[model samples]
Target chain A: MAIPAGITGAAWLLRTVIDARDLTTEVAMVYLAGVLLVASRRSWGPAVAAVLASVATYNFFFVPPFYTFHVADPKFLITFGVMLAVGLTVSTLAVRLQRQADSARERERRTAALFAMTREFAVETSADEVARTLAAHARTLLDCEAQVLMQGPNGDLHPCPSGAPAVDDNELPAAQWAFHYHKPAGHGTPTLPGSSHLWLPLLGARGPLGVLGVQLSARGASLAPSQRELLETYVAQAGLALERVVLAEESARATVAAETERTRSALLSAISHDVRTPLASISGAAATLLEDRASVDESTRRELLQTIWDESESLARLVADLLDLTRLETGTLVARKEPCPMEEIIASAMERMERRLAGRQVRTDLPDEVVVAPVDPVLMEQVLGELLENAVRYSPDTSPIDVVLRREGDLVALQVEDRGPGIAPGEEEAIFDRFYRGAGSAGARGTGLGLTVCRAIVHAHAGRISASNRAAGGAVFRVEIPADAGPGTDRLSPAGAAL
Target chain B: MSPHRPASEHPPGVLVVEDDRRLRATLKAALAAHGFAVTDAASGEEALALAKERAHDVVVLDLALPGIDGIEVARRLRAWSTVPILVLSARGQEQSKVQLLDAGADDYLTKPFGTNELVARLRALLRRAGRGDADPTAAMLIIGPLHIDRAERRVHLDGEEVRLTPTEYDLLAALAKNAGRTVTHRRLLAEVWKDRSEEHAGRLRVYMTYLRRKLERAGRPRLLTTQAGVGYRLNAE
Candidate 1:
C-alpha cells in the first residue's frame, strides 16, 4: 500500500530538515501532516502522541541550523502550541461523529429486533407457545442459550423446556433473584458478577412474568452496554405476550362457567314450576276421592284417577328430559349402541304416546324389510315420542300424522310429517333451539325441551336431525342414524348409557 | 263442611303449609275429605305457629313457603315434635331432599303429587308413628290374594311365591304399606327414585305396571286399582 498523503508529507519534511534547508517551512509542514493523521485516526491519545512526535522530530532535525534537539528561535515554540491545539480539536470532532454513527446502528438493530419479536408474539395463541417463541428469538438475538423460568404456584421456578439446556441451581438462583427483584443479575452485573449466565427478569405490567437466563458462549466476553438495553426490551415484550395469553385463557374459562351457572339456575326454576302444579292436582284429586268415596259414583272416581295418571305421566317425561338435557350440556351423555330394530322403537313410542295422541289420526309407512340401526332404545323411543307428540300438538285432528322410515346408503332415516300450519320461513332453525316455540303457535302444551332433547340424543348417536316445511304443508322433522351392520360396531349396555 | 263431626273423630290433624292461596285451599279441602282435620298456612311462620298450637299427627309442609324454606320449616318442626312431617317441595333437587330427610322428616313428597299418594304417605307415616321401633319383619300385609312378608322381602299369591324385580318389589312394598289408601304418583316416584325428582312419573308408571302384572291375579286387578286422576290404591278390604 502506498503511504498516506499525511505520512508522506511527514517524511518529506524530515528530509528537508536533515538538509538544514528552509527549517521554518519544514516544521510548519510536518505539524500540518501530524494534525491530518490525528484527524483520520479520530482518537484523543493518538492525536496528542502525533503532536509530541512532530515537535520532537522538528526540534531534533529541522528547528535548528543543523540536526539538534534544541529550538533556537522562540517563534518556533508558537508553532508547536498551534500544532497540539489543531490536532486535539480535529480528533474531538472525528470521535464525536464516530460515536453518533455507532449509536444509530445500535438503535436500528434494536428496533428491528423488537419489531420481529412483537410480530411473532402477536401470532402466538397460547402462553407456552409464546414462551417457546420468545426463548428462541431471545437466544438468537442475545447470541446465548436462553431459558425462560416461570414462577410456579409454590414459588418454585418452572423452566420452559423448548430445546434449551437445563440451568444449574446456582445459575437458576441468579435468575430467580432477578425475577424476584424484577431486574438483571449475574455476569456483567453487580450482583453475582462471577456467574456465567446473564439473568434478566421479564417485567410485565402486572408484575414479573418470569426470569430469562442467558448462558453466553466463550466468544462473548461481556454484553455491550447497548446489548443489555436490548435484552431488557426483549424480556418486556415476552412478558407482555405471556400476560395476554394468560388473560385470554382465564376469560374463556370464566365465560364457560358463567354459561353453566345460568343454565342450572334456569333449569331449577322451570322444573320447580312444572313439578309443583301436577303434584298439587294429583294430591287434591286423591284427597277428594278418598273423602267422598261413598257420595261419589264409580265414574267420577275413575275420571279423577285418569287425570292423576295422565298428569303424572307428563310430569315424568319432563323430569326425564331435564336429566337428559343436563347430561348433554355436561358432555356426559353416553349412547348405548345396540342393533335395535326400528319397528320395535317405533311401536313402543306409539304405544306409550297412544293416550296423548288419542284424538289424532296416525299413519305409518314402515317397509317390510326390517331396518336396524345402532342406537339406545330408550333414547330412540324418546326421540320418536317427542316427534309424535309434536305432530299431535301442531297438526289439526282431521289431518293425519305420517311416520316414514327408510334406509339410505349405510344410514337409516326417519321422517315425521304433519299436515297443519307449516313452519314459517326463517323459523326452521329457531324451532330446534331450547325453549323456542314458533310465533303464532300458542296454546301448545310442551316443555319446549322435547325437540332440544331429541336433537341432543340424535347428535349423541352420531346422527343428524333437521326440520323443514313439507311440500304438502305442515312441518317435517328428519333424523338419519348410521347403520350398525358395518364393522367396528360396539354394543353398549343400557346402564352405561344413562346420560 | 259438617261441624258436627268432631275434630278428634277425624283420622288425623294435618297442617298444610303452601304459599299459593288456591293450592293451599284445594289441599285443605281435599285433605278434609280424606277425614283429616286439615289446617292451612300460607307462610312458614304460620305453619310453625299452627304446628305449635296443636298436637298435629302429621304436617304437610311446602318447601317454598313465604317466610322460610320448607326444609327449614321441617328442621324447626323436628326440633320439638315427633310428628310425621311430609315435605312438599317444587324443586326436585336430590341434595335438598336428602337434607330435608336428614333434618328429621320421615318422608319427602315432591309437588304435583296425586292425592292418593299423598294420603298413602300420610297413612304410612301415621302407621309408622303408631308402631315405634316395631319389627317390620313381624308384620305381614295382605292385599287381596297377594301376601307380603315385609321382614323376608317375599311376596306370595295363593301360597305360591312370585319372583319380582328389585324395582317391582319396592313398588309393591310401598303400596302394601299404604294398603286401603291411595298412593299418589309423586310419592311413588320419590320412593322409587330417591334421587329423582317428581318429573319421573313415566318411570314410576312403568314400574307400577310391572308390579301390577306380577302381583295382580288374572282377569282382576283388585289389589292394585288405578284411581284414575288420583293414584293407585292397594285395597286390603
Candidate 2:
C-alpha cells in the first residue's frame, strides 16, 4: 500500500511541473510512467491499486478545475480509460515474468540438491546407507518425517534400520500400495488419500524398487507442486543408488564364491594325496605283519613295525596341520596371550623337536638378560617348531642351524637361520600361502601347511613373520612379536652366572 | 617295551576311561602288555562306578568323554579318593588340560602319543602316588645329580653347592617334589608364591631362568626343563 501511494504522490508532483505549458497529454504520460514503475517492481495487488490511484490523482489535479474531483472536458476520460488499460496489461505481464523467475530459482536449487545427493550416494556401498542419505535430505528440505522402505530378499518392504524414524504400522499398506502400483498414495495422493503421509514409488528402470514415504500432513503442511516434483526426483536418484549397491554386492559375492570353489578343490586334492600316502604305508605294513608273522624274519618284522610307527607319526602330524589350518581360516583360534620368557618358549620347542633335531648342530644365541614378551606360549612354540622343522628338513645334518633371540626395542625378534639353500627368490611370500610347497620340497614329508599355520599364529599375536635369504648362504625365517610392557614385567639385571 | 612288572605279588591296577571303542581297546591292550591289570570303561560315569567298586592304582581318563567330562570326573574323584588321574588330552586343548591337572589330575599325555610315552607318564604318576604322601616335611629330596636339603634349604648340583635366592629355592623345591612329572602352572604358583594368580607367572618364569643359569655345570645335562604351556619339570635322568 505504501509503494502504490508513494508512486501516486511522485506522479502528482511531475504533473505540477508539466501543467505550466498545458501539455495535458504529457501530464497523463507522467502518471502512466509511475503506474508502470509500480507494476514492474511490486506484485499484482499493489500494482493494480497504483493504477487506480494514478487515475484518480490525474483527474483531480491535472485534468480540470484543479484540486477537485471534477473533469473539465469529457476527452480526458478517454485518456483515463487508455491509461488504466495499459497499466493493467503491464502488471499482468510483470507478475507472469516474476513467477517464471521464482520457479526457475526453485528448479535450480532442487537440481543442486539432486547433484549433492547423487554424489553422496556414489560413495555409499550399501542400500541402507543410500536410504539414510535420502531420508536425511528429506527431513531438512521437505520439513517432515521421512522413511525409505526397501524390498528385502523375500520381496517384502522393510524400513532401513537406523536410517529413518519409526514408521506407523497403519501407513504400511499405503506404502505397499505405492510400491506395487508404482504410483503415489496416501494423504496428498489419489490412492489411500486418508492416510497421513504421502507415499511414492521409487521407480527403477526394471520396476519399482521400493517406496518413499513423507509425512507432510503430520507436519500440518502440504508440499507445493514443485516441491512434490523435487521429492520424486530424490526418490529416483535413490532408487538408482540402491540398484548400484545391490549389483556391486552381488558381484562381490560371486567373486568370493568362485575363489572358495577353487580353494576347496585344491584342499581336497592336497588332502587326498598327502593323507593317502601315509595311510598306504601304515596299512601295508600292518597287513603284511598280520598275514605272515611266522614267515617273517626277526629283523624284517622289526623293520615293518618301525615303518608303521614312523608313517603313523607323519600321519598324526599331517592331521594336526590340517586342524590348525582349518581353525586359523575359520577365525576360531584366538591367541590366549600372557607374558612369557622367550628363552623358555624356545627351550620347550626344542625339547618337543628333540628327536628330529638329534645329532644336528643346533646353535642358539640368546640374550643374557631375560626377554619377556606377551605371547601365547603354546602357539609360539608351534611357530618355532615349524620353523625348526623346516630348517632340519631342508638343511644338511652336518650344517649348523642357528636360533637367535633378541629384544629389539619394543619388539621380540626370533630368527631361525639354516645352512641350506635359501628361499627361492620371488617365492618369499608365496611360501606362506596355503598348500605352497617349494620346488625342492616336493618329496619332503610335510603337509605344506606348516608355514601357513606359522603365519596365522604369528598374526594372531599381532606379530609379523617373513622369510629371506641369509647373507651367509642360507634361509632365515624371522618372527617379530610386539613386546609391550604388561603385568609382572620387572626388569632385572642379567644373572651373574648366566651361561 | 615289555611287560616289566614291579616287584610285588599283584600287578598295579589301571582304570582306562575312553569313549571311542577302538581307542579304549588299544589302551587296554597296551597297558595290559605293560603289566598293568587294565580295567576299561567307555564313559566317565562307568569309570566313576568302577573306581568305587575297586581300588585302582591309577586312573587314565580321556578328556572328551561323552557323559561327565574329564575335569568334572577328576573333581568328583578327588572328593572321595586319592587315585592318581592321567588325562589323555588332544593337541589343541591346552587350557582344558591345565584345568584338568588343577582339578586333582597328576599328569597328562597329549593324543597321538606313543605307547612308550603313555606307559612312562603312567609309571611316573604311580610312583609319585606310591610315595605314600607328599611328606612336605621330608628332610631331603634327591632328583638326578641335584639334591635339595630341605632342612638346611641348600641345593647342590653335581655334588657342588649352588647358591640360590629364597624364591628360586622355593620354585625348584616345588618342581623337585614332583620331579619327572609335568606340573601345571597353577599348582606351582600356589606352591611357591602361595597365591595362584596368573600375574605371578612372569615372575616365576624369570626366577626359573635364574635358577637354570645357577644350576648349569660343565659337561652336565639340562635338568630344569620347561613343560611348554605347563610349568617346570625337574628331569630325573
Candidate 3:
C-alpha cells in the first residue's frame, strides 16, 4: 500500500519542478508502474484500487486544470483517457501472470502427494493394511474423513478388518449400494445424495472389490475441477492396491494347498512300506506254528492253530485296506459291476466276525422277498465287514447288533445298528475321513482306516454311506446303492444328501 | 508212504519268490513241513535264474519286486514254459491279478494266507492239471441252450453263435462252471473284470441286467438265478 501511495505522490510533486507540458507523459508513466507493482504483489481487489487511484491522480495533477477540478483545453481530456487506459491494462496483465505461477506450483504439489501414496500402497501386505493406507491418504488429500470397506462372502460389505477414519454403521448402506452397483453414491452423486459421505466403489478387473467413503466440509465444497481430479486419481490408485493385496493372499493360499497335497502323497508311500512289512512277519510266524503242529504238544498245537487263524484274518483285512486306500488316493481304484444278492454277503461278513459277536444278541431284519442288487460283491462285503467290526468293537457285549436291509424307490439301503453310545454330534461325517478315530474309542486298537475305507468303497460304487445316532440308543451305519446300478449317485438318506 | 508206488513223488517242488526275508523263510519252512520241497529266492532276478536251472511243479511269485515286477517275470516265464504260476499279492489288487493272468499267470492268492489255504490252492491246481494232462479246457460247460466251449473260447445261445464282450464271456463262463451252485458276487467280478473296488459290484448288477437282455430268445429269456443274497447261479431249462 505504501509503495503505490508514495510513487503516485512523488509523480505529482515532479510536476511543480518541471514544465507541466513536457513532464505530463513522464508523470503518467510513473503512475502506471505503481499500479503494475501493486497488482503483481496483491490480489485483484487491491490491484484494481491502485488502477482507479492512479487515474484520479493523473486527472488532478497532470491535466490542463492542474490542482483544480476543471480543464481548459479540450485536447487534455484525450491525454487523461490515454493515461487511464495504460494503468488498467498493465495491472490486468500482472494479475494474470500471478495466477499462472500459482497454478503451476499446485500441479507439482499434487504430483508429489500421488507419488508418495503410490509408494505407501506398494508395500502393504494385506487387505487391511491397504485399506488403512487408503483411508489415511484420502483424509489428508481430500481434506475430509475417509473410510474403507470390503465385501464378505455373503455379499455384505464389512468395514475393513480394521482401519481408522472409519465409516460409521449408519454409512454402511450407502457404501454397500455403491459396491453393488459399481458406482459412486451419496452426497454430490445422484444416488443417496442426502448422505453425509460420498461412497465410491473400488472396482477391479473382475468386479467391485470394496468401497471408499469420504465426508467433506464447507472448505471442501469450493474445490476446483482440478482438485477433484486429483482426489479421483487417488481413489483409483487405492482400488488397484486393494486388489493387489487380495490377489496376493489368494495365491499364497493356493500354494499352501499344493504343498499339502505333495506332502500327503509322500506320506502314503511311506505308510505302504511300514504297514505291509510288519503284517507279513506277524502272520508268517503264526502260519509256521500251524503248519508244524506235529512236533508240538497238544496244548501248544491248539494255541498255534488259533493264533494262525486269527492273525491271518486280521492280516488279510489290514493288507486289503492298505492297498485299497493307496489306490483310492491315486484315483486308480475303479468299480467293477456284477449282479449279486445282498443277504448272503452280509451274512458272510457276520460269520467272519462271529466269535466276537457270540456273546452279543444278533438279529437279521431282511425282506421276505429276495432283493437282488447289481454290485461288486467284494467291495460291498468289505464295506459291510468294516461296519460290523466297528459295531462289535464299540458296543457292549450284552448289546444286540441288528443287520437291516430295505429297499427304497430306486435304491437299496443296508444298515447295521449297534446298541452302543450313538455317534457324537457334529462328528458323524468326520469319522469317515481317513485316519479319524472316534473320541469314545480311544483305547480301542485300530489303524483308523476301517470306516474311511468303507466310504471310499461306497463312493466308488456310485452310492452313499453315513453314520448316525439311532432314535433308540446306539449308532447306525447305513449304505445306499442304486437298484439299476449304472453309475448312480443317489444318497443313502435325505439327511446324508443335505450334508 | 510206499516208496515204489509209481507216484511222481511224495513231496511236490515249489519255487517261492518273496522280497521280505522273514516271510520268505517262514513260507519255505511251512511248505516244507506240509510234505513239499520249497526253494527260496529273494528277488525276481534270482527267481528267474533258479527257474532256468531247475524245474518246479508250481511257482509262487510276489508282485512287489525291486528291479522287475511280478508281471514282467510272468511274461518272461511264458516265453519258455507253462509251469502254473501262482501269484502272491496283497488283497484288493485285482488289477494286478488281471495283469498277471494276462501275462500268463495261472492263479493268485493274496498275502497272509494260512498253510491250509496255500495247500488247498496248490492241490486244486495239481488235481485239475492231472485230470486233463494235455488239455485243461476240455469238457464244454452247458447251461440250457447256452453252450460255452472253454477250449474254443466261444459261447452259443439257443444253438446260435453269440458274440460276447470279454467281461461278459468271463461272467457266463464262471456261472456255467458253477451251474448248479451259486457263485458269489465278489468272486464273479474278480474273475470277469478283475476289479476289486466296491463300485464294481454296482456295475456288476448293471451288466447282469444287460446279459439277461442279450440272452432273450423270442422274448423268453432264461433267468440268471440268485440265492443267499450274495451270489448268482444259472438255472438250466
Candidate 4:
C-alpha cells in the first residue's frame, strides 16, 4: 500500500508541475510503472495490493472530475481495464522469478553441505570414525540428535563405538528393522511411526551396511523435503566409506594370518629338534647312572650326574626362549616402558647371567655420566642378556667380551662386543630369523630363538637391534632405543636425600 | 597349634603351596631331602588353613593358584603373622612380582628353578628372619671386602675408609641390612627414600651405581648385585 501511494503521489506532483492538458496516457503509464516496481521486490500478495492503490490514486487525482471515483467519460473504463490486466501479468511473473532465486540458493547450500561431508569422510580410516563424522554433520545440518548403529558380525545392530550416544532401547528395534530390510523406517515413515527417532538404512553398493538414527528437535518434527534428501545423501556416502574401511581391515588380517602360518611351521621344527636334543641327553645320563649304580665309580657317577644337570638347565633355557618368542609374536608381550638408567639394565643382565659369566672375561664400558631411556626395564634387560648369551655361546671362553653403553644423538646404543670369530659374511641379518643358527656355532647349545626374541623386544620398544662383524675379530650386537634424557643430572633431581 | 617335636630339636618347617599336584609332591620331596619338615597345599585356601594349624618357619607360595591367589593370601597372612613368604612365579609375571613383594612377601623365585636355588633363597630368608625382627643397626655388617659399622655410620673397604654421600650410604645400608638376601626395589625405596613408588627405581639404581663405584676395588668381585627386574642383593660371600 505505501509503495503504490508514494509513487502515484510523486507522479501527481510531476503532472501538476508540467501543467499539461493531454497527458492522461502519461499518467496511466506512471501508475503501471508503480505496480511493476512493487511486484519485482515482493510476492504476489503485496504486488496485487500495490496495483489497487495505484489505480485509485491515478484516477482521483489525474483524470477529469478527478476528486471522486465517478468517471466523467465512459472511455476511461477501458483505460482502467488495461491497467488492471498489465498489473496482474507483471505480479505473476515476478512471483515466479522470486521462487527461482530462492530455490537456487537452497540447492547451493545442499551441494556445499554434501561436498563438506564427502571431504571429511575421505580422511577417515575406520568405520567408527566415519560414523562419528557423519553423526556430527547430521546434528549440525539437520538440527537433531544423530547416532549410527552398524551391523555386527552376528547380524545384529550395534552402536558404533564413537562419541555419538547409543541408540535408545525403544529405538533399537526400528534401527535393526531398517538395517535388516534395507529401508527407511521409524518416526516419519509408515513402519514403526511411534518411534522417537527416524531410522534410515545406509545402503552401499552391495547392500545396507548400517542404520542412521536421527531424533529431530521439537520444532523440526518434520524435515523439509530438501533436508530429507540431504540426509539420504549423507547416509549413502557413509556406507561407501564404511565398506572401504572394512575391506582394508580384512586384507590386513589376511596378511597377518599368512605370516602366522609361516612361523607356525618354524616353531614346530624348533621344538622337535632343539627340545628333543636336550631331552635325549637328560634321559640318557639318568639311565646310565641308574643302570650302573654298583659298577659306576665315584668319579664316573659324579660325571653322569653333572651331565644330567647341565642338559636339564639347557632344556629349561630353550623352553623359556620359545615361550618368550611365542608371546612376542602373538602381541601378548606388552612392554611396560619407563624412564630407566642404562647402567642399571646392564648390571641386572650381568647379575642374572652370573653363573655363566663367572669364568668368562666380561668388561663393561659405561659412560661417565648416566644415560636414561624410556624402556621396559625387564624386557630391555632380557635383550642384553640374550646378546651376552650369544657372545658366550659363539666366542671362546678365554676371550674378553666388552659391553659398551653410549649416547648418540637422540638414541642410546648398547653394544655387546666379543673377541672371537666374527659373524660369517652376509649372515648377520639371517641369524635373527627364527631358528637360524650360526654356521660356525655347530656345537653351541642354544634354542636358536634367542636373537629372534631380542629383535622382537627391540621392535616392541620402537627401537632396532642388529648384529655386525667388528673390524677387529669379533661380532658386535648393537641395540638403539629412544632416550628420555641425555647423560646429565639437569632433568632429574636427587631421589632419596639431598646430595 | 602345637608342634609334635620341640622347637630346638625339630627341623625348620616349610609350607609349600602349589596348584599342580606333581610339582607340589616334588617340592615336598626336595624340601624334605634338604632337612625341612615339609607341608604341602594344593591351593591358597589349603595353604592358609595349614598355616593356621602349624607354625611354619617359612612359606613357599605360588602366585597362580585356584582359590585365594597368592597375593591375597600374603595380604591376609601378613595381617597376623610376620612369617617369611617366598613367592614362586613364572617368567612373564614380573609386574606381579612387585605387587607380591609390596604385599609383604619376603622374596620370590621364578619357576622352573633348581632345587638348589630354592633352598638357598629359603635359607637366606630364614637367616634374615631368625636374626629377629628388630633393626640390625648396632652390629657391624661385613659383606665380601666391604665392612659397614652401622652404629658408627661408617664403611671400610679392604681396611681403607670409603667416602660415600648420605644418599649412597643410606642405600648401601638398606641393602646391607638384608645382606645375602634379595631386597625388592619397593622395599629398598621405602627403607632409604621413604617412598615406595616404582618411579623412584631409576634413582635407586643411580645411587646403587654410585655405591658400587665407591666400594669396588680393581680385580675384586662386585659385592652389590642387581636381581634384574626385582631389586638388589649384597653378596656376603
TM-score of 1: 0.47
Clashes of each: 28, 0, 15, 0
Q: How does chain A of every candidate compare to the true chain A by TM-score? A: 0.61, 0.80, 0.56, 0.83
TM-score of model 3 vs. true structure: 0.46
Measured against the true structure, the TM-scores of the candidates, in listed sequence, are 0.47, 0.79, 0.46, 0.80
Q: What is the interface RMSD of each candidate, in Å?
A: 12.5, 4.8, 10.5, 3.5
True contacts kept of 1: 0.00
Q: Who is ahead in TM-score, 1 or 3?
A: 1
TM-score order, best first, reads 4, 2, 1, 3
> Per-residue lDDT of A1-499 in model 2, one digit per residue for the tens?
5654665566566656554647678778777887788788778988888888888877877776878988878898899999999999999999999989998998889889989999999999998888889888887788888888989889999988645567889999999999999889998778889888888888777888788888888786668778877888898898888888888998999999999899989989988998898899989999999997799999989999999998898888889988988897788877878778898888889888988898887888999988888888899999999999999999888788999999999899999999988888899999998888887686777778899999999998889999999988899999999988554463322332231
Candidate 1 predicts chain B with a TM-score of 0.55
Per-residue CA lDDT of model 3 for A1-499, tens digit only, reads 5765687678867866664667867876787677667666777777777767766666776766677758787776776676556656666787787888888888888898888988998998888887778788777877777878888878788877444544667777778789888888877888887778888898778888888888854234644677678878887888898888878989999998998798688657755754665467566757767677678788876776675565556556665677788786567876665556576566556655656676777677977644556677667887888888889888887888899999888888999999888788998998987667788887775557788889888888789999899898899999998877433423222221232
**Candidate 4 backbone clash number:** 0
Per-candidate alpha-carbon RMSD to the true structure:
15.0, 6.0, 17.3, 5.5
Tell me the tens digit of each residue's lDDT in model 2 across B88-202.
Answer: 9999898888788778787888889999999988887777676643466788888878889999999987789999888889888988877766677888878887876866676
Model 4: per-residue Cα lDDT over A360-477, one tens digit each = 9889998887777878888999999999988988888788899999999888999999977889999989999988888888887787888999999999988999989889889999
Model 2 misplacement above 4 A? A8-33, A50-89, A152-187, A190-211, A215-220, A330-351, A354-381, A398-415, A455-466, A478-499, B1-10, B132-237
Query: Which of 3 and 4 is ahead in DockQ?
Result: 4
